[model samples]
Target: MVYFNERDLCYNSIYPHNNSWTMSRIELDACAECDLLLTPARPAVGDKARCPRCGYLLQRPRKQSVARTFALSLTGLILILPANLLPLVGIKVLGNTRDGTLWSGVLTLYREDMWAIAILVFLSSILVPLINIVLSVLVSGHLYFRRPNRYLPYWMRWLQHLEEWAMLEVYMLGIIVACVKLASMADLRFGFGLYAFIALLIVNALLASCLDPYLFWRRIEQLQHNHRHEN
Candidate 1:
């Protein structure tokens, strides 16, 4: 079962190679319930538990992923509002002071004709976190309510795919780089937002660790079967 979300609306894989080709395709399996397309994993014991199709776990939901994703998502959400509202970094040189927020950096990139970089920054730093929080809530609610949707499995799979692109740690690295360069030029002040962003980064990592696409997909199939009998 795949839950209804933007995450379920697509699929694309990028293979590793010197001249790798990108395979962009939306999975279209018939909906058993809730109009979702479920793509099952080839189950195998041991180290290769990941789905060959999309690299999701072939087994069930990992308990560790559940705990980590939930904890991180909750904490990240809490920190998110403040991370945007508070000043990220402040710089003072020659008695003149300047402050930078998340938007400031994006805008700077935009003005420089670095639209691609700006978009990447926007997606990773802003959009991806929001999607992760929203998807986690929906996926968790579906599991908790046990109200299986046909699309649930597909959503779970796609969510994991989306999760990979939401690299909060990478964003943090960029921030650290910027801070180092800024510090060499002037006296810099780190603010609450910086701490919040760091916390968010840890939260994102935890969420990824806790998520298991396989568990959700299996649950979805069972749900569809159960619903058929009821009808």
Candidate 2:
């Protein structure tokens, strides 16, 4: 049975129908963009549910979401250090060579008294992405193991909001622009870190694609409910 709270516009389920059942599970959820209350259908794998009014996507089922997200997030976590710490590119001009790493770039900006830009870059390019990946791992890992954690809901909420602030693609675009501008002026060489950064970017993209937020919220709710009953 689906019990919806009108006050918060959230649904609480009791004895939710199994996926194997012929009937689609009904759950109430509010559209994030329009705040319209909706009873989204449980989408089949490869299917999607959309808000009728705004056309905002409400749900999309991803097969093996927990395992896929966990693996990709772990890979991203492994790549983060090298991507930020190691030199991304090397430049040579008149027998002088200089290499640039993400961390070094932020430090350079700060040293030049562009602290505001430095902090912005650091948060958007590095810190936020790290947090996003870490939270993905934590939430997906617990869900994969069928372990319940009271903080899962909080982590998932943060993960959803943090997606916008993780600007790795923007940073990569800036790198490409700089490389094109410098190509005519000096010898340019790509570093291992560049490849690592690219891989991390791809993994993050895949992680986002594989995560099913609707499924995750339902699983977290079920897990927490079961835990409370057991206690």
Candidate 3:
């Protein structure tokens, strides 16, 4: 991927690589992530393009992408309770066994005076996931409804902000590391919450991958534009 100035992208797209190419086609597209001007090319259904500089997905048109993302977001949101309330794992230590849910673990930590770590764990693992799921649903809902939204930019920015803090991947890595360390120390058992967590990660990641912010913004722009014309 090549880094491109937003100005250059806009300008070059107006200019031409060659007169013949320009004469034949004149559509210009911008990379959502980098604002790199891309010559528009019609792609097959399964085709996808990525920005060379940022590896940001440029275009990947699909049937029902917004609908699918909305569905996935709903599924993830529904799983939130199971992922946190059910037992994440059962642990056996010195012949004593106990099953621990996320809240249970947090309570245990708090009781043990590890409030800071407990808070950190709860926020990253629980709260962040919830916010990400909720925001995803909202974003996809807007696309699905295609309503006039004056706060489109703010909505997208809010989602992006929440996205940066939603650390399910990091928390999962921490869990894996902890599991490995505890292998020899005790008998470890995976539980419903653990499975739910895994599923949540899969669904949320899928939602993120399917969502194209650029497409979202464009849709919003079109809707607002149409609304204006109607008015």
Best by TM-score: 2
lDDT for model 2 comes to: 0.87
Q: Could you arrange the candidates by TM-score from highest to lowest?
A: 2, 3, 1
Residue-level lDDT tens digits of model 2 in 149-208 = 989999999999999999999999999999999999999999999999999999988998
Which stretch of 10 consecutive residues in model 2 shows the poorest summed lDDT? 1-10
**Order of candidate numbers by lDDT, starting with the best:** 2, 3, 1
Window of ten residues with lowest summed lDDT in model 3: 1-10
Distance from true location, Cα of 184 in model 1, Å: 1.9
lDDT of 3 by residue, 127-175 (tens): 8779878877877787788866677667777887778777888878978
Clashes of each: 15, 0, 3
Candidate 2: list runs displaced more than 4 Å.
Answer: 1-26
Q: On residues 112-207, what C-alpha lDDT tens digit does candidate 1 reach at each position?
A: 999999998888778877877877866666666667676776667767778678777777777789888887889999988888877777776666
Which candidate ranks first by lDDT, i.e. highest?
A: 2
The whole-model lDDT of each prediction reads 0.66, 0.87, 0.76
Clashes of 3: 3
